[model samples]
Target: MGTVRPNVLIILVDDMGYSDIGCYGGEIGTPNLDSLAAGGVRLTNFYNTARCSPSRASLLTGLHPHQTGVAELVNNDGPGGYPGSLSLRCATLAESFRAAGYHTHLTGKWHLSNEREQPADTWPTRRGFDRFWGTISGAGSYFQPTTLHDGETPVPLSDLGPDFYYTDEIGTRAAAAIREATTPFFGYVAFTAPHWPLHAKDSDLAETRGLFDEGWDVLRTRRRQRQLEAGICSDDATLDHRDPAVPAWEDEPEQKWQLERMEAYAAQVRAMDRAVGTILAALEETGQRENTIVVFLSDNGGCAEELRSDPEGADQFRRHHLIIPPTAPDGTPMKVGNSPGISPGTADTYTSYGQAWANLSNTPFRRYKRWVHEGGIATPLIVSWPAGGLTGDVIHAPHQLTDIAPTLLEATGVPALAERDGEPVPALPGASMLGLLRGGEPVEHDLFWEHIGNAAIRSGDWKLVREYEGPWELYDLSADRSESNDLSAQHPDRVQDLADRWQRWADAVGVIPYGDVLAARATMPTQPA
Candidate 1:
C-alpha cells in the first residue's frame, strides 16, 4: 500500500511534573503513556516556555510567546480587543492542517482568548479549528465551570449533571471526535486536570490518599533519585533546594490538609491518564493507531500559584471577593479563599500546596513554572508512531515547543502558509525532527525563553538563566542539568556574547513590546552578563 498522510494527536496535560510518570521513572501509574513511550521516542530534554498560554502559543504557531502577542497572559481591552488574543499575523496548527485538507478539532482548555468586548469571531472556531469543545476561561471548577463551550455555543456543566467531571468529559468528547473525524485529522486534546481546586471523586481520591503523607522532603529526594536513574538528570549533579517562599516541612504543622490536597491532585492525574487510555483505545478501534503521530507533553512545570494566598491583580480580587451564588442567582453573597486549615474537597476552600510542594513536584529542577531554570521549563515529551515511523528509544537532543507546528507540517507534507494580517509572520524558528525520530541527529537551534523579567538563553550545551529577583546563573547543561554550578565568573565573555545575541533576537521579535509589563521590564539593567 502507498504511504498515507499521518494523522496528528497532540495530548497536553496541565502542570504535570517531569518525573511523575512511568516513562520518566516516577511511581505514578501511567500505563498508557508508558506504552506510548516504549513504542516511540521519549524526549529527554523537551523545553516549554515555562507557562500555559505562552507555551501553547509557541507550540501551535512555531514562534516565541512574545511574537504571538501573549508574552504574559491574556490582557483584553476595548472593542479592538485583547492584543494578547490569537493575532491574525500567525497561522495556528489547526489553520495549517485544515488548509492541508485535514479535519481539525480541540477538546479541553482554551486559555488563549476570553475578552468580553471582543467579538465572538475572535474565538477558536473563527480563528482556525473546525470544532472546539472546552472551557474558554483560564481555570475554574473542574465539576462546574463558568464559560464552558461546545463549539461556538455556550454549554452548561450541569447539562452533564453531577456525574460530569471535566477531565473525563474532555476525554470522552475527544474520543468521540476522533472516531467521527473524516480522513486525516489533527486532534489537539488539552486537559486542565491536576491543575487546581483539588476536587476529585471520593473513589478517585482514595487511590492516592496516603501516598504523599510522607511529606515533601522524602518525596523530593525520591523523585530526584528516580529522575537521575531514568537519565533525565545527571546522577553526579546536585539537586537545588526549594525557593525561599517555601516553608521547610519541619515547620509545617497541619500536615493532614496538605496530604489530602496532594491526594486530590494525584487523583486528577490518574483520571487524566485513564482518559488518555480511552482516547488511545478509540484510535486503536478506528484502526488509525499505527498511522497516527501521537505527541504528549505538559505546557509547563508544576504551577506554584496559590490563587488565594498570592497578592496579585486578578488573583487578589477573586480570592477576596469571590461570591458563589446559592443557585446561580443574582447577587448571592459568597467568599472564596485558600485558607491553610480548611479541607480542600469542600466548596468554600480554595487552596494550593504552595512553593514547598511545588519544589517536590519539580524534583531535581532548580525553579518552578515562571522561571527559566530546568524545573520551571523542562517537560516530559513522549512521541509515538507505530507504523515503523518512530522507534522506541530515548532522544537526548534538545527540543522546544515551537518545533511542534513545523514538525507536523514536515511529517504530513504540508506547507507553511502566508499570514492573514499585514504584520508578516516570522520565518519558522524551529527545525524539523523527522530525521531524529528516524534515528538520525536532530538539527540544533539556539533555544531562548523569557517571561516577564525571567530570562534564559541556550546555545549548544551551555545555558544562561536569570530569575526575576535573582542574579545571573550559568550552567554547562552537559555537566550540570540541575543548574547547581555557577560558571558565570569563569565564562563572563561567553555570557556577555550570548546575552547580547539573545537581546538582539528579542528586539527583532518584539519580546519587550510597549505595555505595562514592558514598562517594568524597561527598568531592569539594560544588559546583564
Candidate 2:
C-alpha cells in the first residue's frame, strides 16, 4: 500500500487540446482532473513537442526527441535525427527509476518503438519497465486496437472479452498496478483517449448528447472567457480568429454528424477523467496519496486532420494507415472515418472530431497539431503533490514537456543518469522545474522546439517560430499567449538572434531541414513487405 520512497504517476493523453479539461476552461466534464487542479498547481504556459511520438520521447528521456531517435513518428525518416524508434542511447524515466530500485508499470499507448512486427529493445518492457499493457502502434480502433500487447507478448482480440474498452481497461490496469505495488512505483498511464478514432461507450455518449449541439463558434468563445476567469491564461491574452479553413457553424452542411463527433470526443475525455479518479482512489486507499506526485498533461494540441466524409470510410482508414485495424473483434465490418449519416460513439464506427471541434478544444490558441504555433504546442499541466503542502494554486511561468523527467527524478531523490554503458547519454535540454512547482521563483532560459520542418526557439518572453518553408514569425508570449500579433517585422534583430539560436540547437540535436528528411525517405530502399 505504501513505501519509503515517493510514488510517481504520470498520465499522458494523446492529441488533447490546451483547454479541453474543465480546470483549464473546457466545458467537458472532467471533475476528477478539476479536483486535482483545484487542489494542485495548474501551469498557465506549458508546451509539448507538437506531435505524439516526439513529445513522448522528450518527456521520457529529458532530451529533445531528435537526440532520442524519435525525430518524427515511428519510422526512420532519414539519417540525422529521423530514426523514428526510441534510441537506447538515452536514459528513460523508467530506466532511471528502475536502476534506482523503483518498480515501473505502463498501461496504454506505447508508440515509442518502430518494431511493430516483433519485440525490440525500444519497447517499454525491454526498456526497464516491470509491466506493460497497451498498443505499439500510433492510432487504431478503440474497440479492437492493432498491435495490442500485454507486456512483451501480443494480445489476441478474442481474449479482450465482451465488455472490453481500451480506456476502461487502461484505467483499471493502472489502479491495480498502483494498489499492488510492493515497492516505490512509477506508473505511466498513457491513455489513447481524445485522439483520432472518436469511439465512446453508449452510456458515456448519452451523457454527452446535446452538449456540443451549439457548434464550435459558441463553445470556443465560452471556453476562452472561462479561461480568463479561472486565471488559466494571462489577462492580456485574447482569442484569435477561427481557423480560416473552417466554416461558420451555421453554414456547415453536416450539423448532426458534427455534433455526434464531438459527443464521442467528449465522452472519451469524460471516461479518461473517470480513470484518473480511479487511479487517485487507489493511491488514497493505499495511503500513498500524500507521498505520490501525480502529473497530468496532453501530448499535443487537439488534432485537425479531418477524416473522410465519404461512404467508404474504412477504405480511407486503410489507405491512410495500414496499421489501423480493418475489422472489429466480432469479425463484423468496422467503419472508419467521420462520414455523414453515420452516428459516431459506437464500436462499429471510428471517426474524429474534426478541425472545427479541435479549434474549440484548443480555445483561443492559433494553429493545430503538427505546426509549431501556440495551438499545436501549448498544453495545460496539472501537478499534484500533497506532500509538498499546498492547498491549491496556479504556476504562471512557462515550461516544456522535457522538464518533466528531470523534475520527477529530483523529486523522487534519484540522480540523473549521465551515461549508458560508458557512452555519454546526450545532454538534456531541460532543467528541473521542481523548485518552481514548490513555490520558488521561476527561472528563465531559452526553450527550443522542432517537428517536421516547423521550428521555434523561446528566449525570455519572446518566441520565434516558422512553418516548414514559411517565413519566421515572432511573438511576445508574456502578453500574447494566443500568438495573435506578429512582432517579427518590427524586431528584426531579435528575430535574427532567435533564429540563430534555434539553428544551433537544431544542429546540436541532429535536426535536418524538413525538406531534406522527407527527400531521404523517398529514396530509401523499400522494406521487404
Candidate 3:
C-alpha cells in the first residue's frame, strides 16, 4: 500500500569534469557509473556552487555558504572556518537523517573544518555523523595523509597498510559501513581522486600511460563533440578556449611530463569508479540494492588548482605564500619557473594540469571551476533509484546543490528538525525534487550563487552572471549553453533587473564583501571606530 523507504548513498567525487565519465562522453572508462546512468536518470542541467567547500556547505546545510559561515575554504584562523570551515549555526544533512533514525557515516575528504584537533564538539562526531573515518585536510599525500581521522582521533593512515590507495580505502570503508550499519544508513562517501598531488597505483597509472599522448586539443575537441551528441548542450554552443595560464601543447618543453600528469589523473578517477562498483556490490549483497537511492555527482567542475610539491612546500604555500616563485618585471619567474620534472605522482609536488588542460577537461563548457559559467559550475548528476520510485528519464531542470538535502529528506521521509539542543537552526532552503523524480511536472525555480563577490542568478531560461573583475554577462541558457554570445549590451533592462535580483539574494544571505572574510574578522576586534 505504501512505498518502501530506501537507504541513501550520496557519492561525491572531487574535481571531476562534467564530461569526464564515459556516460558524459570522455575517454575515461567507468563501467560502474555507466551502469548507474543506464538504469537511472541522467541530469544534464544540475549545477554546483562552483567550489569545494562552498558546494559542500550548501549541499549539506541546504543554505548558501555565506549563511553557513563557510563562504570559502575553512582555515583554523577564520571564524566559523570562513575560508574552509563549517559554521556552528548550520545543521548538516547527516544530522537530519540521523534525527530521522538513520545511521550516519562519512569517509574521505572532510574539508568542513579541522575540529579534530580542537574540541570534541567541533569535530565530525559533533557535526551529526555517528561514525567517521577520513581526513580533515583538503588535499595531501595520498600515501600518508595528514589529519587522517578515526572519529576525532588523529591516526596515521599507515594503520590501513602501505599498499592501500586512498580512493580504494575510502570506498572499502564506505562499503563496510553499509554492511555494518544497523539501521537505514546515510552514507556520504566523498572520494578525493583527480584532485592535487595525483598519485595512483603503479598498475592503475600504467594503464593510462599512453592515453593522453593524443594531446589536450584532440582530446578536448573529441569530448566536446560527444557532449553535443548526448544533448548535453545546444549544438551551436562554442567550445570555450583554454585559460591563459595553460601553455599550448606544442609549446610545452616536456610532453612526457604533461602526458604523465594527465595519466595519473585518469588513473585516480578509474580507481574511484572501481571503488563505486565495490559499494554497489555491497548494496546488492545486503539486499538493499533495488530500494536504495544512490546519487553520484562531482563536488565542482574540473579543478585547476596549481598543486605544490611536498607537504612542507604545500604547507608553506598555505601558511605564508612563500612557495610561489617570485616574478620579474615581465611577470616571468626570475629563477624558478612553472616547470615540469618536479616528478608528478610523487609526494613532493602540487601542480595542476593548468588551464589549457582544464579547458580540455571541461570540454564544451566555457570556464573551469570557481566561475559561474557552464564549465566551472556545471556537473553531471546521476540518480539511481529502482523499485519504480523514480522514472528512468532524463530531466533537464536547473537544479542547485541546495536541492540535494530537501530531495533526500523527502525521498527517505525524513523531516528537518527545527531545533538541536534547544536552539533553532536555519530552515531548509531547497525544494524537494520528488515530483520530478516521480515523473511529475518539471520543477521551476530561480537558483543563486555568490562566492568572493562573483555572483550569478538563474531565473528560468535567463541567467545573469558577473565576476568580480568582469562586466555583467547575460545568457539565455536555453539558447546559449556555451555562453559565447554576451547579451549584456543588447538587453540593458533585463541585465539591470537580474543584477537587482542578485543583490537582493546577496543581502538576504550573508554574502561577505569581496576579499578575505578572515582578514575582516581579524581587524574587527581591535579596530577603532
Candidate 4:
C-alpha cells in the first residue's frame, strides 16, 4: 500500500443478488458499482451465511455466527442454539483496527444487537466504533425507519426532514464521516437498500419504469447469457429453472402489478449504486482513493420476503416489527403491502418486490435467501486497493464472508485482538485473502454454513448441501455452477464424508437442530428481536 496505514472502507448492501450489478450481468443501472468492480478484484464464487445477522456477524468478527452467538436473527431464542446479541468474547473489526491506531467509524445498519427499548452493551459504540449511527434492527421502510440511533442515543423522527430517504442519508453521512476523519479511518457503510418495503426516489424509479415489463421468464435467459459473456460464470453453466412456486409470466394474471414491483426493486438498486458513487467520490476528493482499502458486498442473497396486503392496524404493525415505523415521516398512513392497487415508490407506500421478481434477482439459481443453496449463499465480493496493487482482476476463489475481517486486518497491518473485556477470544477460523487480492493464486479450502435448518459444506470442487429436512445433494461446482445436477447416488461415500465433516463442525460451533432451536424459543417470553 502507498500509505503507511491505509484507510479502510467496507460497503455492505442488504439482500442483493450475485448478478444484480451491471458488471455482474444484471440489466440494472449500477454504473458506480460496475466502476468499482472494474477497478478492483471480483471474487467469482464468494458465499455468505445465507441470512442477514448471521452473515453480518461472520463478516465483522471473522468467526462463524455460532461462535459469536448470532446463528440466526437477533431474536431471543433462549440459548438452545445461540444468543441473539453478539458475544463480546470475539472482537469486531472496529475494535482491532482501533487498537492499531485507526479511527473506527460505523454508519448505517447495526442489526447485531437485539436490544429494542432498553440500552444494551452490544450497541455499535460499545463495540469499539468511535462514532456510530444507524438502525439496530433488521428491516423496515426507507421512508421512516425505526431504531435510528446516533451512538447509543435514539434519533428523533422529527429530525429527518419531509423529503428524507434512508439510503441517501446512509451514503451522505458516510461520505461526511470520511471527509472529517483526521486520522486513518475504518468506516463501515451498511445500506439497508433493496431489502424490503421497496422505496426509491422519483428519478430512480423513472430510470427503471419499463425495465422488467417483459417479466422474469425472458430476463433470466438474458441475464445468464450476460453472466457467461462477462466471465462471471463458466460458459457451460446453465441457468436453473425459475422458482417452482412462481407462475410463468405468460400464465400470471397480475402482469402489470408484477412489472411495477420489479421496477421499484430496480430503482432501489440504482439508488444504492448512486449512494455508492458518493462514497467513492469522497475517497477520491480526500486524496485517499488509491491507498484506501475499499470492499463492497451484500450481506446475503436476494430477499424473497413478499409483502402482501396487511389488515393489521398501524400500531399492531409496529408491535410486530421493531424496525417498522407506524406511519410515514410526514405522518401519512403507510400502505404496507404488495396490493396490486397500491403503486409503490413513494413515501406512503410499502411493498416488497415479491417471489417472481426475486427469481429474476437470483437469476440462474434455484432458491432464495435463508436456504443453503447457491442462490441463497452466493454473492459478489469486490476488493479494491490501488496502492496495494490489487486492481482490475478476477479471482475464482470460493471464499466466504468470514475471510473479510482477516483480510482487512492483514492489509492494514493490524492484529485481531487476542482478548477482549478481560477474557480471551478464540482464534479466527477464517484465513486472510490478502494474498489473493494481490495477484496470488487461489488456495482451495473447506467451507461450511448453516441457517435455520438448512446446511451446506463445500470441500474442494464438490459441494454437499441440503434444505431444512431435505436430502443431501452433491454437485461438482466447477462444471455446474448452477447446481442443476445432483450426484449423491453416484458418490455416496463422498456425501458421507462431507456430512460427517459438517456434523463435526456443527457440534463444535454449537449448532442446534432447527426444530430444537425453535422449540426452545417458543418456551421463552416474546420480545422485539
Q: What is the C-alpha RMSD of each candidate to the true structure, in Å?
A: 4.5, 2.1, 5.4, 1.5
Pairs with backbone N, CA or C atoms under 3 Å apart (clashes), candidate 4: none
Clashing residue pairs in candidate 2, if any? Answer: none
| lDDT for position 240 in model 1 | 75
Local accuracy of candidate 4 as per-residue lDDT tens digits, 31-97: 9988888889898889999888999899899999989988898887885746788998999999999
lDDT of each: 0.76, 0.85, 0.77, 0.86
Residue 293, candidate 2: Cα error in Å is 0.4
Top TM-score: which candidate number?
4
Which is the better candidate, 1 or 4, if ranked by TM-score?
A: 4
**Lowest-sum lDDT 10-residue window in model 2:** 313-322
For residues 1-529, write the lDDT of model 2, one tens digit per residue: 2336788999999999998999999888999999999889998888999999999999988899988888778886656337778887998988889989999999998888778759998999988789998888878778887789888788987788888888988999999999888999998999999887888988999899999888899888889889889988877876786888899999999998888888899999999999899989999999999899999999999999877756675574565443556566667776766678667877777678888888998888988899889899999899998886543778877789888987898888887778877888877678788888877878787889998899898888898999988899999988887888899999999999999999888888888788888888887654210
For model 2, what is the error of residue 76's alpha carbon versus the real structure, in angstroms, after optimal superposition? 1.7
All candidates: TM-score: 0.91, 0.96, 0.91, 0.97
The total of clashing pairs for model 1 equals: 1
- Residue 462 error, candidate 1, Å: 0.6
Candidate 1 Cα misplacement greater than 4 A, ranges: 77-82, 116-119, 242-250, 309-316, 319-335, 346-348, 421-424, 513-529
Residue-wise C-alpha lDDT for candidate 3, range 329-374, written one tens digit per residue: 2344322213475556644344566556667778777677888877
Candidate 4 TM-score, true structure as reference: 0.97
- Kindly give the stretch of ten consecutive residues in candidate 1 with the minimal lDDT sum: 320-329
